[model samples]
Target: MNTAGIGGTDATGTSLRRLADALGTEMMWAGARDRPIGEVVIAEPGDVLADLPGALVLAVGARGADAITVVRSAAEAGAAAVAVRAAPGEDGALTPQVKAAAERAGIALMGIAASVRWDRAEADIRGVLERGAADGTSGHRGDLFSLAQTVATLTRGVVSIEDAAHRVLAYSDSGDEADELRRRSILGRTCPEPYLAHLRQWGVYRRARTGEEVVDVEELPEMGARRRMVIGINAAGRPLGTVWVQEGTRGLAGRTEEVMRGAARLAASQLVDHWFQGDPGARLPSRAGLAHGLLTGRFNSGALAAHLGIAPNASATVVAFDLREPESGDAVSQDARRAEAAEIISVHAASYRRSAMVAQACGQVYAMLPERAAAPSSEGLLTRWAEDLVSALRHHLRTPVQAVVAGTAPRLDDIPAVKLRGHHGLQVLARTPERQVATHTALTASLMVRDVLGLLDRHSEIRHPGLDVLARHDDAHGTEMCRSLLLYLDAFGDVGRVAKDLNVHPNTLRYRVRKAVALAGLDLDDPEHRIAAMLQLRLSREEPGTSPFPGG
Candidate 1:
């Protein structure tokens, strides 16, 4: 079958790596990650594939043993890739035979996640090819509302798009013909949980989640809900924040199915763009495993790099960010807030570096700026670009953001050590919010201090006895003993500066300091006591939610 993509390996050709990276690893696991596929064709159940070089042949409805046959035939047909689908619980990785077929025949095998509609996967893959041909610029990117409007026009029904959690992302303009469910979902941006429970109770959600078929859910008279057809939007197993589409119209099931199926694919393309381009919340958990592994040094670097389409030997810069939310904002989920910051950074990253990839882990979002080996040393350039990212985030989010740009170009194998350095820098930034952006090189002293603080955190027994008397006294008496003492200690007994900062006479500050020292039972005359007292105060300030990667 012809797809709205290239028919040969020419201008529209896309590498398997690009496809996997664009749509995410959840879409398909390739036997080989490097082959270029220009065309997408769906194979009937019994078709003997032949003479289809550079084609991504979708073995639709072919599973188990039949899928194995399609793999072998794809090898004979000179296809660039053969895709097969699997349900949620099935093993979808490449088999030994499939691997051999690809190795010998230069045809990679693709294992499509069960929940993904074949049409969606095809559109997603073809989108990768067409977009690549257009110099990585997509004409129809990130427009779900328009897509929803088109689906409404085709199905003659009111349509709405919601994430799997039932948060409505977009909807089509509609008249009173729209059901109450559609109206509520669009207005509230959430579906009623009880009605969703009914979908689960009748296995409607499961069918929508696991199948490409548009689920026909009849009206629940008891609940006063009207009839609607729904489909689950998933790129892969991780659910990608899950997409749930609803159509509320009558007498068009047979015809609407095909149109809705096409709509699902188009929506998948847009969501995939959101997922990769900037929507950190979508399918993040599914992709987070590998990202976390690579960032934390827990996973095999080479394998993770290949899976992420990262070149192991490529020199790369990793930027760490800490987005401190404003004091007050509307009630939004943490994921939503994180995505907002990440989306802004992602926009800057994409514009600055074509090879940049963004992911979230350690309660922080990271942008991996991949640099080619032969590229000029991006010493000053990367830092400047990162500064722009921080500025953009600050302006757009109206939040204080600290961005730490790693100076050393670390390859995959060095990621753990590099991530550690940046992680320490972030921890330091959590305490010092004055600096907007700091380089890893400049954060050396702060990073060490932060590391020592971490040791105290891990070994609670090593934690110092804080200034309990002074803190409690200030709390009760409305005094500023703790603040005065910390400012005095931080200034190295600079009484004038501390007094000016406190907006008080120097002698008044001196009196308060003396009283604080006496009350806290600390000897200010001794240097050891001064340093120990400062450490104690700093440690005391290290409370919950203060760390950069808090609860990471």
Candidate 2:
């Protein structure tokens, strides 16, 4: 945890003045402006008593008299200050009783914005506490949140860090200058779908997610989105996230991009470090667990939907992410890379959609997009988001990340089937690497072929027994009959091509082909036999040492 409060270092700790600046929007309820805060404690609504001397108590889930009771107890505990949520837009005007309690107990009181989430508030306070104790000075802490503040100051704009998926990570406070879009995003802990859609419509997300140069966004009045300047954060050619500077009530400062570019590089390093070490204090992975449950049908979709704050029957946009790696790569490194990709997707999912859930299943990362209770048009929005996600992952992972959309599942029960389609869609994409993102509907023909190949791969009884007989003949005699026959069929009986391909004589190829047919009692003239042979041979390529009979 980082230290709490800023500036005016004291024998106890930093003063409240520095603390208020550390928390850009926290107002004074009744606290001494110079109260020294040495530590920060998270107070449960009813239980605030502890040996919390010189600590700033953040009373969670408490309001009015309930919060005042904690303040009284904290003061008795010798706490330096207690910060409570103020009524929205009213500062501490309605908390006179709370203030009176603090005054009587000789304890300082502080008012954090009601709109500020308790968890987020605690995070900010923790940053101040952890950093302050390290330096024993400056209220300012060197963390992502403080960096957000520094970026905001340099650009004279509201600043935030967003991953390639457009999820806002830690954003700075712009007070009254913040627009409705930023306010709602902070309040809900995600950017609104409609607003993100608006940005995508103008290709703003593309340039921001893919490139390192600063990209500008004009005000989108239709969506109530303010202008924003986006610069991609990159390290070693892999995107970490983006540094976003939004125009507040004030215009941006001069030479903003020059300073922002350097800050962006620093942010990328910090982000990469954070990914490697991670925050122990981050919220539990309940959302991910619920998502995994939904993907694997381990939990009732209705219940999971309720937990994720989605409607009971909302449609799910299922997209599967597959990380491309070498076939012979170390298994440990491959698993590690997959885990890293999952982490990258999961972090962005938190702030990308209020209900977005990412889970790993069958060695692939699956994201259940924001379940939309609205019209079906929202699927288009989700699709666009998925496309951008693929692009972002390519930049961040620096690998061929194949994403397959399974289309929208109208019912929760159908999501598993949809997930299967996405899984198969990835298989179809594996055969065609020319494109990275594809819809299941777009590859129907290819998927059908895959299904046929899968049948041959899975059920050996349905295969022509002749092929197995022919393969045994080759294994026993060291002959190339089956290989010649496969080549002959592949070339449509073009003897010259087959012989040249094998560096064998044309007469030798024909003799071997005839011998393979005779040994297996194979009917080369039958179209069905030829088609089955072609597919089975293709499947054999996937199974080493088992050619002429796949999955044998």
Candidate 3:
């Protein structure tokens, strides 16, 4: 079988001299001098001419019949040229009849040395084709530059590397060879509006974000891109960017497609490195950087305090703000809103006349503020501040905002723990309807239950056997044994009060509680058993639409 074209052009179009040089043999070219050889085919006995079009037909061991007749038949069948094996120490010769037929039909006849193996000749030709495709101008020599240049050289086109946001990161310098849109993209640092619109219509960005490897685009004359190929770059399962190549005079070859795949991998590494290095001002420590460092355990309270200029005895509170965005907004619009909300919260925190460090992380805004001595209580001050901030933000953005204020951390070392508690409070508030603000001190039970639930979720095998039995009983039999027991414990086993809340007689409540303890194998007399059971019940009731204890 013939090898596929390597460069964007046909292998048959290669010069006869180039093919002979690759094979390291002397050849006499006769008849049809410059015609391209589309393929190399080994000749067989009967009527091989039918399969000979655009082929370099190889004739070996042809001493049986008239070789001139085979050459004339091949030329008639549109074979580009014929390569015949020469006898020992002699140049291969064609009769006048064969040369006349070749000259009439524009087919070149060549002779190969007898010592050269046929398989070696075919391998050499394939290598020549592959190398020709990879060779290009020396200007594209660096890592990214070479990639861009190699892509262009392979496809005979222009290339651009762009972030997910369509910001142009790099582009091949094709000089006058590039089209107007290509030049505009490089100069404006982004794809032009017309071209971007076309890409949007084609769902290019959507495909890129979803980790699609390559997207081929059809001709869009309005955008001046005839045919385009987009290769998405990704890192750690997230989209990094894309490499887009616009076709030049021809479509991309198989070799060019392979090169683009390699380029995408290289682009992913470059993008990850850029993210780690961050932007221009990233070297200087900033509030977000400090907060992130503390959250990830890269820094401690002492370093944070020294940077914020807080006193040793100062009281600090960690507050987190979770902004709600419109459900219909796209990712880009949602990001813009998040940035705006973060900026507003940071400005408000700075206005408190105390040392404040504000940061945004995990899709929420966090602020650590040192309380003034004159404040009535750290919780009271933070509550008032959070309420005011919420109202201002709601009025400005016309969206709901939730805020959580953690308990005061008296020592600098306690700030990280305080921040975690604030996050817990925020999560609890998220589940509660129409209740935006929460304080760590007030939601202690809910936070504790939430933490226990999280642990149980991750390590289900560690669940309390008694709680599991009771939960399964409630789920299967529609019984209120778990609810009654939880309320009984919450009311401190006050028979009268617990009965009133459960809407049952005191004796009846006691009997149900005894049944629950027996069925779940719980020793209610043990304080640890009571606490664990109470926490499990609370988690079950925390689900949406769950009814509270019947009365109080």
> Global lDDT of each model?
0.65, 0.69, 0.64
lDDT tens string, model 2, 132-199? 65563432223456567656755689987765555556677777787878776654345778987777
Top lDDT: which candidate number?
Answer: 2
lDDT of 1 by residue, 1-552 (tens): 322223235434678778778987666564677777766666756876777777778877776666777777877877777887745545433556555655666667777776786646655665566567556322332245455655565456777776555666656666666666765554334676788788779987677777566787888767656767777666665343333334454544334565565556445635665555553323333355676677677877787766666677876678888787654546466566676666555545644654455677766788767777677345577777677668756765677888887655557767667766777678666666777888888878766766676676677676334477677888899998877888888888899988988899999999998899989888888888886677666766655765422112
Which number leads on TM-score?
Answer: 2
Model 3 pairs in collision: 12-37, 12-38
lDDT tens per residue, model 3, 137-164:
1111123444565456545678888776
Runs in model 1 with CA error above 4 Å?
1-293, 296-299, 304-310, 326-344, 372-380, 397-399, 407-409, 420-424, 431-434, 454-482, 515-525, 541-552
TM for candidate 3 is 0.39
Q: Rank by lDDT, highest first.
A: 2, 1, 3
lDDT of 1: 0.65
